[model samples]
Target: MLTVELGEELLIIKSEQPLKVLSSAMLNPGIGRYQYFVNRTVDKNYYPEDAKCEYEQFLQQYTMPLQMTVAMMTAVQQRFVMREQYVDGETTIDVFITAGLGNAVDVTQSYQYTYKPAVGTINIFVFVDGDMSDEAFIQAYHCIIEAKVKVLHERGVIDKQSGTIATGTSTDSVALAVKERGEFHAYGGSITRLGALIGKGVAATLHKAIDGYDAYQKGELR
Candidate 1:
Protein backbone atom coordinates (compact mmCIF):
# COMPACT_ATOMS: atom_id res chain seq x y z
CA MET A 1 0.00 0.00 0.00
CA LEU A 2 1.01 3.63 -0.49
CA THR A 3 0.23 6.68 1.62
CA VAL A 4 0.37 10.31 0.49
CA GLU A 5 0.59 13.34 2.75
CA LEU A 6 0.42 16.95 1.68
CA GLY A 7 1.78 19.58 3.99
CA GLU A 8 2.43 23.28 3.64
CA GLU A 9 6.02 22.75 2.54
CA LEU A 10 6.14 19.14 1.44
CA LEU A 11 4.43 16.30 -0.43
CA ILE A 12 5.38 12.86 0.89
CA ILE A 13 4.71 9.41 -0.49
CA LYS A 14 5.39 6.50 1.78
CA SER A 15 5.20 2.80 1.06
CA GLU A 16 4.32 0.16 3.62
CA GLN A 17 7.52 -1.71 2.84
CA PRO A 18 10.92 -0.87 1.42
CA LEU A 19 10.98 -0.44 -2.35
CA LYS A 20 13.63 -0.72 -5.01
CA VAL A 21 13.81 2.79 -6.45
CA LEU A 22 15.36 4.41 -9.47
CA SER A 23 15.22 8.18 -9.31
CA SER A 24 16.64 11.47 -10.55
CA ALA A 25 16.06 13.17 -7.23
CA MET A 26 18.66 15.56 -5.87
CA LEU A 27 18.98 13.55 -2.70
CA ASN A 28 19.72 9.87 -3.08
CA PRO A 29 19.69 9.63 -6.84
CA GLY A 30 20.01 6.16 -8.45
CA ILE A 31 18.83 2.67 -7.59
CA GLY A 32 18.32 1.85 -3.93
CA ARG A 33 15.94 0.60 -1.25
CA TYR A 34 13.84 3.43 0.08
CA GLN A 35 10.59 3.76 1.95
CA TYR A 36 10.01 7.51 1.79
CA PHE A 37 9.95 9.87 -1.19
CA VAL A 38 9.55 13.58 -0.68
CA ASN A 39 8.92 16.64 -2.82
CA ARG A 40 9.76 19.84 -1.01
CA THR A 41 8.21 23.12 -2.07
CA VAL A 42 10.60 26.06 -2.13
CA ASP A 43 10.24 29.72 -3.03
CA LYS A 44 10.14 30.65 -6.71
CA ASN A 45 13.33 32.65 -6.23
CA TYR A 46 15.12 29.90 -4.39
CA TYR A 47 18.78 29.61 -5.37
CA PRO A 48 21.34 27.99 -3.16
CA GLU A 49 25.07 27.84 -3.55
CA ASP A 50 25.13 24.56 -1.64
CA ALA A 51 22.15 22.49 -2.71
CA LYS A 52 23.24 19.36 -0.90
CA CYS A 53 23.43 21.24 2.37
CA GLU A 54 20.09 22.85 1.66
CA TYR A 55 18.38 19.54 1.13
CA GLU A 56 19.98 18.06 4.18
CA GLN A 57 18.75 20.90 6.35
CA PHE A 58 15.19 20.76 5.03
CA LEU A 59 15.04 16.99 5.56
CA GLN A 60 16.18 17.25 9.15
CA GLN A 61 12.75 18.51 10.14
CA TYR A 62 11.27 15.10 9.57
CA THR A 63 12.08 12.04 11.65
CA MET A 64 12.28 9.83 8.57
CA PRO A 65 15.36 7.81 7.73
CA LEU A 66 17.34 10.45 5.87
CA GLN A 67 19.50 7.87 4.12
CA MET A 68 16.41 5.94 3.01
CA THR A 69 14.64 8.92 1.48
CA VAL A 70 14.66 10.22 -2.08
CA ALA A 71 13.93 13.93 -2.31
CA MET A 72 13.22 16.51 -5.00
CA MET A 73 12.48 20.21 -4.84
CA THR A 74 9.95 22.27 -6.78
CA ALA A 75 8.64 25.80 -6.78
CA VAL A 76 5.03 24.74 -7.14
CA GLN A 77 3.05 24.82 -3.94
CA GLN A 78 2.28 21.51 -2.32
CA ARG A 79 -1.42 22.38 -2.23
CA PHE A 80 -1.46 22.18 -6.02
CA VAL A 81 -0.09 18.64 -6.12
CA MET A 82 -2.23 15.91 -7.71
CA ARG A 83 -2.32 12.13 -7.45
CA GLU A 84 -3.80 9.13 -9.26
CA GLN A 85 -3.83 5.35 -8.85
CA TYR A 86 -4.59 2.40 -11.12
CA VAL A 87 -5.09 -1.16 -9.97
CA ASP A 88 -5.51 -4.23 -12.17
CA GLY A 89 -5.49 -7.74 -10.78
CA GLU A 90 -2.30 -7.99 -8.68
CA THR A 91 -0.67 -4.83 -9.98
CA THR A 92 -1.10 -1.35 -8.56
CA ILE A 93 0.47 1.94 -9.67
CA ASP A 94 0.33 5.21 -7.75
CA VAL A 95 1.44 8.53 -9.18
CA PHE A 96 1.98 11.86 -7.47
CA ILE A 97 2.90 15.03 -9.36
CA THR A 98 3.39 18.76 -9.06
CA ALA A 99 3.95 20.98 -12.10
CA GLY A 100 4.91 24.54 -12.98
CA LEU A 101 5.80 25.82 -16.46
CA GLY A 102 7.79 28.96 -15.81
CA ASN A 103 11.01 27.38 -17.02
CA ALA A 104 9.64 25.17 -19.76
CA VAL A 105 12.15 24.11 -22.41
CA ASP A 106 12.39 22.13 -25.62
CA VAL A 107 14.86 19.27 -25.37
CA THR A 108 16.09 19.70 -28.93
CA GLN A 109 16.91 23.38 -28.51
CA SER A 110 20.40 24.54 -27.66
CA TYR A 111 20.37 27.84 -25.84
CA GLN A 112 23.28 30.10 -24.92
CA TYR A 113 21.17 31.71 -22.24
CA THR A 114 18.61 30.30 -19.85
CA TYR A 115 16.34 31.45 -17.08
CA LYS A 116 18.08 32.37 -13.86
CA PRO A 117 16.93 30.90 -10.57
CA ALA A 118 14.77 28.49 -12.61
CA VAL A 119 11.46 29.19 -10.92
CA GLY A 120 9.33 26.33 -12.21
CA THR A 121 9.67 22.55 -12.41
CA ILE A 122 7.69 19.32 -12.77
CA ASN A 123 8.25 16.61 -10.15
CA ILE A 124 6.80 13.13 -10.44
CA PHE A 125 6.85 10.24 -7.94
CA VAL A 126 5.48 6.83 -8.85
CA PHE A 127 5.09 3.73 -6.68
CA VAL A 128 4.22 0.33 -8.08
CA ASP A 129 3.36 -2.72 -6.07
CA GLY A 130 5.26 -5.98 -6.78
CA ASP A 131 8.85 -6.70 -7.71
CA MET A 132 10.47 -5.49 -10.93
CA SER A 133 13.76 -6.35 -12.57
CA ASP A 134 16.39 -3.62 -12.86
CA GLU A 135 15.87 -3.43 -16.60
CA ALA A 136 12.14 -3.17 -16.16
CA PHE A 137 12.67 -0.47 -13.52
CA ILE A 138 14.59 1.66 -16.00
CA GLN A 139 11.98 1.00 -18.66
CA ALA A 140 9.26 2.15 -16.30
CA TYR A 141 11.17 5.36 -15.70
CA HIS A 142 11.36 5.96 -19.44
CA CYS A 143 7.63 5.31 -19.77
CA ILE A 144 6.89 7.97 -17.17
CA ILE A 145 9.03 10.55 -18.98
CA GLU A 146 7.39 9.73 -22.29
CA ALA A 147 3.94 10.12 -20.81
CA LYS A 148 4.89 13.49 -19.34
CA VAL A 149 6.23 14.82 -22.62
CA LYS A 150 3.20 13.52 -24.51
CA VAL A 151 0.87 15.47 -22.23
CA LEU A 152 2.92 18.63 -22.63
CA HIS A 153 2.68 18.29 -26.39
CA GLU A 154 -1.07 17.62 -26.31
CA ARG A 155 -1.53 20.67 -24.08
CA GLY A 156 0.45 22.77 -26.56
CA VAL A 157 2.94 23.90 -23.98
CA ILE A 158 5.38 26.24 -25.72
CA ASP A 159 9.00 26.97 -25.04
CA LYS A 160 9.30 30.73 -25.05
CA GLN A 161 12.96 30.63 -26.00
CA SER A 162 12.65 28.21 -28.90
CA GLY A 163 9.05 28.98 -29.93
CA THR A 164 8.51 25.20 -30.00
CA ILE A 165 6.71 22.63 -27.93
CA ALA A 166 8.27 22.26 -24.49
CA THR A 167 9.20 18.72 -23.51
CA GLY A 168 9.44 19.67 -19.85
CA THR A 169 10.82 22.25 -17.49
CA SER A 170 14.59 22.50 -17.10
CA THR A 171 14.53 21.08 -13.59
CA ASP A 172 12.01 18.30 -14.06
CA SER A 173 12.58 15.24 -11.84
CA VAL A 174 11.03 11.78 -11.47
CA ALA A 175 11.28 8.77 -9.15
CA LEU A 176 9.98 5.21 -9.56
CA ALA A 177 9.65 2.88 -6.59
CA VAL A 178 8.73 -0.78 -6.94
CA LYS A 179 7.87 -2.98 -3.99
CA GLU A 180 10.51 -5.71 -3.65
CA ARG A 181 8.08 -8.61 -3.52
CA GLY A 182 5.81 -10.76 -5.66
CA GLU A 183 6.72 -11.93 -9.18
CA PHE A 184 9.80 -10.31 -10.73
CA HIS A 185 8.55 -8.57 -13.83
CA ALA A 186 11.10 -8.24 -16.65
CA TYR A 187 9.53 -5.74 -19.08
CA GLY A 188 7.99 -2.29 -18.87
CA GLY A 189 6.94 -0.57 -22.02
CA SER A 190 3.95 1.29 -23.41
CA ILE A 191 2.68 -2.05 -24.77
CA THR A 192 3.08 -3.88 -21.45
CA ARG A 193 0.30 -3.87 -18.86
CA LEU A 194 2.56 -2.43 -16.13
CA GLY A 195 3.81 0.28 -18.45
CA ALA A 196 0.31 1.13 -19.60
CA LEU A 197 -0.80 1.60 -16.02
CA ILE A 198 2.19 3.80 -15.29
CA GLY A 199 1.64 5.88 -18.39
CA LYS A 200 -2.06 6.35 -17.75
CA GLY A 201 -1.56 7.22 -14.12
CA VAL A 202 1.23 9.71 -14.81
CA ALA A 203 -0.62 11.39 -17.67
CA ALA A 204 -3.82 11.79 -15.67
CA THR A 205 -2.08 13.15 -12.59
CA LEU A 206 0.08 15.56 -14.61
CA HIS A 207 -2.94 16.97 -16.42
CA LYS A 208 -4.68 17.70 -13.14
CA ALA A 209 -1.58 19.27 -11.63
CA ILE A 210 -1.05 21.50 -14.65
CA ASP A 211 -4.69 22.59 -14.73
CA GLY A 212 -4.66 23.22 -11.01
CA TYR A 213 -1.52 25.33 -11.26
CA ASP A 214 -2.98 27.35 -14.12
CA ALA A 215 -6.17 27.94 -12.19
CA TYR A 216 -4.23 29.09 -9.17
CA GLN A 217 -2.17 31.45 -11.28
CA LYS A 218 -5.33 32.96 -12.79
CA GLY A 219 -6.91 33.44 -9.36
CA GLU A 220 -9.55 30.80 -10.12
CA LEU A 221 -8.36 28.51 -7.36
CA ARG A 222 -7.44 29.49 -3.85
Candidate 2:
Protein backbone atom coordinates (compact mmCIF):
# COMPACT_ATOMS: atom_id res chain seq x y z
CA MET A 1 0.00 0.00 0.00
CA LEU A 2 1.26 3.50 -0.85
CA THR A 3 0.09 6.28 1.41
CA VAL A 4 0.52 10.10 1.03
CA GLU A 5 -0.44 12.14 4.03
CA LEU A 6 -0.34 15.94 4.41
CA GLY A 7 -1.56 17.21 7.72
CA GLU A 8 -4.87 15.25 7.61
CA GLU A 9 -5.09 14.82 3.85
CA LEU A 10 -4.50 11.32 2.49
CA LEU A 11 -3.77 9.74 -0.90
CA ILE A 12 -3.48 5.98 -0.68
CA ILE A 13 -2.29 3.91 -3.62
CA LYS A 14 -3.05 0.20 -3.29
CA SER A 15 -2.56 -0.67 -6.93
CA GLU A 16 -0.61 -3.73 -7.89
CA GLN A 17 1.57 -1.42 -9.97
CA PRO A 18 4.54 0.24 -8.29
CA LEU A 19 4.33 4.02 -8.29
CA LYS A 20 5.96 5.36 -11.42
CA VAL A 21 7.35 8.71 -12.52
CA LEU A 22 7.69 9.16 -16.27
CA SER A 23 8.92 12.75 -16.32
CA SER A 24 9.24 15.99 -14.40
CA ALA A 25 8.72 19.33 -16.20
CA MET A 26 8.74 22.49 -14.16
CA LEU A 27 7.12 25.94 -14.68
CA ASN A 28 7.30 28.82 -12.26
CA PRO A 29 4.40 31.16 -11.54
CA GLY A 30 6.12 34.42 -10.83
CA ILE A 31 3.75 37.37 -11.28
CA GLY A 32 0.83 36.32 -9.15
CA ARG A 33 -0.33 33.57 -11.58
CA TYR A 34 -1.64 36.09 -14.15
CA GLN A 35 1.56 37.54 -15.50
CA TYR A 36 3.00 36.32 -18.77
CA PHE A 37 6.55 35.04 -19.05
CA VAL A 38 6.83 34.82 -15.29
CA ASN A 39 10.09 32.97 -15.28
CA ARG A 40 11.68 35.73 -17.39
CA THR A 41 11.04 38.61 -15.04
CA VAL A 42 14.77 38.74 -14.26
CA ASP A 43 14.63 39.81 -10.66
CA LYS A 44 16.29 38.30 -7.60
CA ASN A 45 13.12 37.50 -5.63
CA TYR A 46 10.86 38.05 -8.61
CA TYR A 47 11.47 34.49 -9.83
CA PRO A 48 14.27 32.34 -8.63
CA GLU A 49 15.13 29.32 -10.72
CA ASP A 50 14.56 25.84 -9.38
CA ALA A 51 17.15 24.67 -6.89
CA LYS A 52 17.56 21.51 -8.96
CA CYS A 53 18.43 23.80 -11.95
CA GLU A 54 17.21 21.26 -14.47
CA TYR A 55 14.73 22.55 -16.99
CA GLU A 56 13.12 19.14 -17.55
CA GLN A 57 13.48 15.80 -15.81
CA PHE A 58 12.74 12.45 -17.39
CA LEU A 59 12.43 9.21 -15.43
CA GLN A 60 12.32 5.53 -16.32
CA GLN A 61 8.87 4.06 -16.77
CA TYR A 62 8.71 2.99 -13.13
CA THR A 63 5.39 2.14 -11.49
CA MET A 64 3.44 4.30 -9.06
CA PRO A 65 3.89 4.50 -5.28
CA LEU A 66 7.26 6.06 -5.98
CA GLN A 67 8.86 6.16 -2.56
CA MET A 68 11.58 8.49 -3.81
CA THR A 69 9.25 11.21 -5.00
CA VAL A 70 7.56 11.09 -1.61
CA ALA A 71 10.87 11.74 0.12
CA MET A 72 11.70 14.76 -2.05
CA MET A 73 8.27 16.20 -1.47
CA THR A 74 8.93 16.05 2.26
CA ALA A 75 12.30 17.80 1.98
CA VAL A 76 10.96 20.69 -0.09
CA GLN A 77 8.27 21.25 2.48
CA GLN A 78 10.83 21.48 5.27
CA ARG A 79 12.96 23.95 3.31
CA PHE A 80 10.94 26.84 4.58
CA VAL A 81 9.70 28.04 7.94
CA MET A 82 6.47 29.99 7.95
CA ARG A 83 6.75 33.51 9.25
CA GLU A 84 4.04 35.75 10.67
CA GLN A 85 4.02 37.56 7.35
CA TYR A 86 3.10 35.92 4.05
CA VAL A 87 6.58 36.72 2.69
CA ASP A 88 7.86 34.08 5.05
CA GLY A 89 5.12 31.82 3.77
CA GLU A 90 5.79 28.95 1.40
CA THR A 91 4.73 28.84 -2.18
CA THR A 92 1.62 26.83 -3.13
CA ILE A 93 2.24 23.50 -4.87
CA ASP A 94 0.45 20.69 -6.77
CA VAL A 95 1.06 17.30 -8.43
CA PHE A 96 -0.53 15.83 -11.56
CA ILE A 97 -0.64 12.22 -12.74
CA THR A 98 -0.78 12.33 -16.51
CA ALA A 99 -1.21 9.06 -18.35
CA GLY A 100 -0.21 10.33 -21.77
CA LEU A 101 3.01 12.16 -22.80
CA GLY A 102 4.94 9.04 -21.88
CA ASN A 103 7.02 8.92 -25.11
CA ALA A 104 6.87 12.26 -26.87
CA VAL A 105 8.42 15.71 -26.61
CA ASP A 106 5.46 17.39 -28.37
CA VAL A 107 2.86 15.23 -26.72
CA THR A 108 -0.47 16.35 -25.39
CA GLN A 109 -1.13 16.07 -21.66
CA SER A 110 -4.11 15.71 -19.38
CA TYR A 111 -3.90 16.55 -15.67
CA GLN A 112 -5.71 14.34 -13.18
CA TYR A 113 -6.57 16.54 -10.22
CA THR A 114 -5.99 19.57 -8.08
CA TYR A 115 -4.48 18.32 -4.86
CA LYS A 116 -5.80 20.02 -1.77
CA PRO A 117 -3.31 22.01 0.33
CA ALA A 118 -3.56 19.73 3.35
CA VAL A 119 -1.17 16.81 3.74
CA GLY A 120 -3.56 13.89 3.66
CA THR A 121 -6.55 13.52 1.40
CA ILE A 122 -8.61 13.38 4.58
CA ASN A 123 -9.61 16.46 6.62
CA ILE A 124 -7.50 15.83 9.68
CA PHE A 125 -5.20 18.66 10.79
CA VAL A 126 -1.93 19.10 12.71
CA PHE A 127 -0.49 21.83 14.89
CA VAL A 128 3.25 22.49 14.80
CA ASP A 129 5.19 23.51 17.93
CA GLY A 130 4.45 27.12 17.06
CA ASP A 131 1.11 28.56 15.95
CA MET A 132 2.20 28.19 12.36
CA SER A 133 0.35 26.21 9.65
CA ASP A 134 3.32 24.89 7.75
CA GLU A 135 1.68 21.50 7.31
CA ALA A 136 3.18 21.17 3.83
CA PHE A 137 6.68 21.37 5.27
CA ILE A 138 5.88 18.96 8.07
CA GLN A 139 4.25 16.43 5.76
CA ALA A 140 7.17 16.58 3.34
CA TYR A 141 9.45 15.98 6.29
CA HIS A 142 7.47 12.89 7.17
CA CYS A 143 7.78 11.57 3.65
CA ILE A 144 11.59 11.99 3.60
CA ILE A 145 11.89 10.60 7.11
CA GLU A 146 9.76 7.59 6.24
CA ALA A 147 11.39 6.95 2.89
CA LYS A 148 14.90 7.19 4.37
CA VAL A 149 13.95 4.87 7.16
CA LYS A 150 12.58 2.50 4.58
CA VAL A 151 15.77 2.67 2.55
CA LEU A 152 18.03 2.12 5.55
CA HIS A 153 15.79 -0.71 6.65
CA GLU A 154 16.22 -2.37 3.28
CA ARG A 155 20.00 -1.79 3.15
CA GLY A 156 20.73 -2.57 6.82
CA VAL A 157 22.57 0.75 7.06
CA ILE A 158 20.75 1.20 10.36
CA ASP A 159 19.31 -1.29 12.82
CA LYS A 160 15.58 -1.55 13.06
CA GLN A 161 13.00 -2.95 15.48
CA SER A 162 10.35 -5.28 14.21
CA GLY A 163 6.78 -3.92 14.18
CA THR A 164 8.17 -0.46 14.77
CA ILE A 165 10.34 2.23 13.19
CA ALA A 166 14.10 1.64 13.05
CA THR A 167 16.08 1.81 16.27
CA GLY A 168 19.56 2.76 15.01
CA THR A 169 20.89 5.98 13.46
CA SER A 170 22.35 6.74 10.07
CA THR A 171 24.26 9.80 8.92
CA ASP A 172 20.91 10.59 7.33
CA SER A 173 18.77 11.36 10.36
CA VAL A 174 15.56 10.75 8.44
CA ALA A 175 16.73 7.27 7.56
CA LEU A 176 18.01 6.73 11.08
CA ALA A 177 14.66 7.57 12.67
CA VAL A 178 13.16 4.52 10.99
CA LYS A 179 15.80 2.10 12.19
CA GLU A 180 14.90 -1.53 12.88
CA ARG A 181 16.75 -4.67 13.94
CA GLY A 182 17.19 -7.25 11.22
CA GLU A 183 19.78 -9.20 9.26
CA PHE A 184 22.48 -6.78 8.15
CA HIS A 185 22.72 -6.28 4.42
CA ALA A 186 24.86 -3.75 2.59
CA TYR A 187 23.88 -2.41 -0.85
CA GLY A 188 25.28 1.11 -1.06
CA GLY A 189 24.64 1.31 -4.79
CA SER A 190 21.00 0.35 -4.51
CA ILE A 191 20.63 2.49 -1.42
CA THR A 192 21.98 5.51 -3.28
CA ARG A 193 19.54 5.09 -6.14
CA LEU A 194 16.66 4.66 -3.75
CA GLY A 195 17.82 7.72 -1.84
CA ALA A 196 17.63 9.81 -5.02
CA LEU A 197 14.11 8.62 -5.61
CA ILE A 198 13.11 9.50 -2.06
CA GLY A 199 14.63 12.95 -2.31
CA LYS A 200 13.00 13.94 -5.62
CA GLY A 201 9.70 12.31 -4.77
CA VAL A 202 9.50 14.46 -1.67
CA ALA A 203 9.74 17.62 -3.80
CA ALA A 204 7.29 16.42 -6.43
CA THR A 205 4.73 15.28 -3.87
CA LEU A 206 5.04 18.59 -2.08
CA HIS A 207 4.28 20.45 -5.32
CA LYS A 208 1.35 18.20 -6.17
CA ALA A 209 -0.16 18.15 -2.69
CA ILE A 210 -0.66 21.90 -2.70
CA ASP A 211 -1.37 22.15 -6.41
CA GLY A 212 -4.86 22.63 -7.80
CA TYR A 213 -7.94 23.50 -5.75
CA ASP A 214 -10.37 20.62 -6.31
CA ALA A 215 -7.95 17.69 -6.14
CA TYR A 216 -10.18 15.35 -4.11
CA GLN A 217 -12.71 15.24 -6.94
CA LYS A 218 -9.83 14.88 -9.36
CA GLY A 219 -12.10 13.97 -12.21
CA GLU A 220 -14.19 17.09 -11.77
CA LEU A 221 -11.12 19.28 -11.66
CA ARG A 222 -9.72 17.63 -14.74
The TM-score obtained by model 1 is 0.95
Give candidate 2 misplaced runs (Cα > 4 Å): 1-12, 15-143, 146-191, 213-222
**TM per candidate:** 0.95, 0.19
Query: Which portions of model 1 show Cα errors greater than 4 Å?
Result: 111-115
Give the whole-model CA lDDT for all candidates, comma-separated: 0.87, 0.23
Q: Residue 153, candidate 1: how far off, in angstroms? A: 0.2
Give per-residue CA lDDT, model 1, range 29-145, as digits (tens): 998899989999988767789987989988898888889899999888898888887886688878889999988999888375566556889999988887777778888899999
Give candidate 1's whole-model lDDT.
Answer: 0.87
**Tens-digit lDDT track of model 2 for 169-204:** 211112111111222112212233223333444334
